[model samples]
Target: MTDIQFDDRVAIVTGAGSGLGRGYALELARRGAKVVVNDLGGSPSGVGASASAAQRVVQEITDAGGEAVASTDSVATRAGGAAIVQTALDTWGKVDVLISNAGFLRNNRFEDLTDEEIDPIVDVHLKGAFYVGQPAYRAMRAGGYGRILFTGSSSGAFGHAWQANYAASKAGMIGLSNAVAIEGSAYGIQSNVLLPNALSRLEEVMTPGYMEIPAFAEALQSTDFSFADGRMTPEFTVPLAVYLVSEACTATQGIYSSNSGRYSRVRLAEAEGWVSPAGTTPPAVEDIGANFEEISELRDFSLPAHNYDEFTIAAKVARARGIHS
Candidate 1:
């Protein structure tokens, strides 16, 4: 395989003060990309802010002979998001890459989640992407080149027992990424999502509860798993994050999951369901029950490329059922 480099590219990494975001910033800088390290410096539950978190990462990059600047702006507000993107444009004149990885956690059961908890998560993870993404997208369109990555989570894509708010927020990242990918296709821009499992302060807080389970505890201690440092440290995810937002990434709307040191693609496919026969009367509840097995089966499916794919697929199904020519 050939080496992947980001020479002369201007990249912005939000939440770069620590964890996976910091790892991405450092590696991108090392590979010749001028980085804008933006971090709100907030606590895990979205509580406070300080400049030190972002500034420290900036110092590390500069000390290593790399170019970077720190932005202590929040990704939760529209103005803050624009400011974060502006930090990059003001210094570099263009934005070639964006890693929208800034977010906070608020875990709770669905019934117990409050508006207060859910609102902040959505503001930072979902709206924040739009805030930063809008400006970066325009710059990319003008420059006619760009790569975008949204940090997603398994808690969102799958489900977690105590992370309803966080999960919902992360799931929105996938939808946002897909929309951007569709519109960006005409503008030399590509967008994708990353669901990474890395050890961070956020994980530190969540892991203890899972360790109480017997099977979970056993897996946690297993040596069969692979990781960048014998554990799910943030470094293991940096390379995959970097690639998704690099010139070398070929697919837009792609979703990748990084766990330990193993990487894999995550896709959303539409299952082909059973169609009522042409000229047949509407099925009653009992008729539907009789065909439930075929309806729920996953033997046939298609990965849609855009919103219109469903209509196209529907037309195909109708023709095959003799409903139309």
Candidate 2:
């Protein structure tokens, strides 16, 4: 396939002050998308805001001969999110792509984590995506075309130590992306989540012993080791993201993991478990316990579109046995 380009599209990239968001903003701008570079300029812990980080990225984009505008808006608030989207509209006249990449991290053991720690993480990572996306989604619905790329994380989809709050926030993004994909389909808007493993501010908090794992180390090292002095850089993952949030991409409701020149899709599905006869009284706990292996078998599974689809499958099984009651 030819390289994807966004010739006349307008794009919004949050958290673009640094790290992965910066790379995405620059790449999209380079591809001819008029970009709204939205960043709160907050620290990795999500404290203290500055405008320079965002403006610096905008400067880099324009200096590289790409079109972009700076937005120092906090995505954690509804008003801030609206301002971020407004920047794109006021400057470019339309919004075609939204990369919900703004996020912050707080690391603590599950038990040690507090509501205070959890709320801000949720605000920046999960709720922030919703705040920014809701307005952008409506605009896209009106325009009849759009693309949304959500920044999920391996910490949530896979697992990570000392990241209970962060994981919950990241995991919530998957649900958000899934719903957006379904709702935006008729409007020509596609939404997908990315579990990106790249070098960024969050990496500093990662336990060093964890990186000793072979898979972890390999995943951390980009093909060009020089990018991060023998580690991965944010740029390695941004290309795939740009394509996923481009008009050229038709994929939606997908979870993708990208790093070190690798890209793969992640699907959430359920097995077709053993079912009890519908007319029969509710099966005893012993019956369910006895059939645990069959129930948990992964040989055949259905990728349900929603909770109703799974129930629909159960309904089909009940009808098939002529046991509906």
Candidate 3:
């Protein structure tokens, strides 16, 4: 196997001050990619700010014989997003990679969630990706090559309680990533989403007493990268990320999850559903009721890679009805 390297690449890692983002920046730079580390240095709850977090990571990168620059601009605003990308351009002349990892946590029961929690979370996670993604896409398009990664959370897939705001925002990244992947395919720009589960300060917000919980405790038993039970670190997620955003990867529009020291692909599939026996008119209430099992069955499903693929079932229905050739 050829050793993967990024000797001539330039990468922008948002939220690089700490946690998974910090690990990503270090590894990418160690592999020869000149990195622009952007972080708001805000608290996990989305309040307060500092420059030390970002600058510290930059210092670590440089001290390790890697090239890196620090940017303390927020990813939650358009101006900040543009400025973040501009930082990379001004320093390196191009952006060959983007790890859209900037986000803060704000969660509560759906009914108890206030606009304060909802708006900022959405603005930083979903809108933040767009604010930077659009400009980064343009740079990638002009250069005709790029790799973009969106940091989505697995909580979005399996409805965790008290995570209404955070989960929704994370889910939005998948859609944005899919759209970028489709449009970028022709330009040699690949886009993918990551659902990372690593031990980080956000745990202070996500689950205050997680260690005391039996389920959370049992899952983190030093599988490989972990040193003990209930301690799965961010370094474990670095290699997977580095590969996905490298020249060797051809996958795009892909959703992946890394949890409990295991990595897997999560898919968005459409099930083959029961069709109404009668044509043109909608199915009767009783007819629909009779086929609930078939409608909900996942025995036969198709994974649509593009928007137009959704009509496949419709075409099949039309053919069965002899509606057209």
Q: Give the best candidate by lDDT.
A: 3
Candidate 3 lDDT, 1-325, residue by residue in tens? 9989999899999999999999999999999999999998899998988999999999999999999999999888999999999998999999999999988887676788899999999999999999988888899999999999999988887655677899999998889899999989999899999999888888778754434546645665533553435546898788888999999999899998877667899998887777765457888899888998988999977788787987876577557656634
| True-structure lDDT of candidate 1 | 0.87
Cα RMSD of predicted structure 3 = 3.6
Give all candidates' CA lDDT scores. 0.87, 0.87, 0.88
Clashing pairs in 2: none
Residue clash pairs of candidate 1: none
lDDT of 1 by residue, 13-67 (tens): 9999999999999999999999999998989878889899999999999999999
Each candidate's number of clashing pairs is 0, 0, 0
**Model 3 spans > 4 angstroms off:** 207-231, 317-325
What is the alpha-carbon lDDT for the whole of candidate 3? 0.88
lDDT per residue, candidate 2, 1-325, as tens digits? 7878889999999999999999999999888988999988888888899999999999999899989999998999999999999888888788999999998877776787898889999988888998999999988998999999999988899877678898889999999999999989989999999999887996665556545457756776644555345346887898889989987788999999986767899988888778886655889999999999989998977888877788897776567657654
Weakest ten-residue segment in model 1 by summed lDDT: 204-213
Q: Which ten residues in a row have the lowest lDDT in candidate 3?
A: 222-231
